[model samples]
Target: MEIIAEFGSSLLIVGCVLGFFMAWGIGSNDVANAMGTSVGAKALTLTGAILVACVFEFAGAYLAGGEVTETIRKGIIDPSLLASTPHYLVYGMLASLLAAGIWLLVASIFGWPVSTTHSIVGAIVGFSAVCIGSESVNWGKVGSIASSWVVSPVLAG
Candidate 1:
């Protein structure tokens, strides 16, 4: 219970809380997407839809979510910099995650649907700007990523 007294355990607890919220959000959103057809066609009743969604969503979060987690691997930053000051890098990464999690949590609480990708990207930019200065951050990659907002839908449609 002494989260403040113990840094490692505090992080574990924080991670668990964040993980729960993240899983819940991902599941609920995906459930709507996956079951929309079934619900529309009346193939699955409302209760059936809810039950199937809750069960499969929990299973998917616990199993499939662990399949590929390279997104949190921090390969975006140079390895040499991490080695030089491990705590800074770790703190930065943790802070970025927490910031994004907080943003998502607040958004969900207020019933405002937002993209998790955008939340994470904003967090990364915040941390990168703080740690490496604005100049050190690559604007080109950021521009391209931002540009995709308009490009993807325009091309697909």
Candidate 2:
């Protein structure tokens, strides 16, 4: 649509803001989850954990985020399906980001410890299903992700 074209640049800004919000939510939740045990065991002080997370999150993203980012961007949903209407994909991604951020906020407020990965994945699935159709989604990948979510805590324990 003409509107999308006209405001394409603005959409980038919006995307960045949404991405920041989502990342913030994820970082807060994940760092707490990661450092909880250490703090509980008195192995690390709360301040130390916070400091470590601040440094390590940036380091981790800078050092190891690329492959995972690429895989998520390319493999999660077949973007080729929206080749002609790429704006839909943009809209869907934005919706997913916002959805995930809101989900994280609500979960935090309710004292329900939830995985940020699960929130984002569920948002992506819902957005893709509604925007593109269920056929466009790779359920096998989703299944794998779900299994990992279940397996991770057990493995950690």
RMSD of each: 5.1, 2.0
List where candidate 1 sits over 4 angstroms from the true fold.
Answer: 1-13, 27-72, 135-138
Candidate 1, residue 25: Cα displacement in angstroms equals 4.0
Question: Candidate 2, residues 1-157: lDDT per residue as tens digits?
Answer: 5547898789989999999999988876788788888999999999998998889988988998997677567667788998888888888989999999999888877767788888888888888889989988888888887898899879999
- Residue-level lDDT for 121 in candidate 2: 83
Q: Encode model 1's per-residue lDDT on 1-95: one tens digit a residue.
A: 23234577767776677666665665455466677789999999989999998888677658866642443344234434446555666567677
> In candidate 2, how many clashes are counted?
0
Cα lDDT computed for each candidate against the true fold: 0.66, 0.85
Q: In candidate 2, residue 99 scores what lDDT?
A: 96
Candidate 2 residue 64 Cα shift, in angstroms, is 2.5
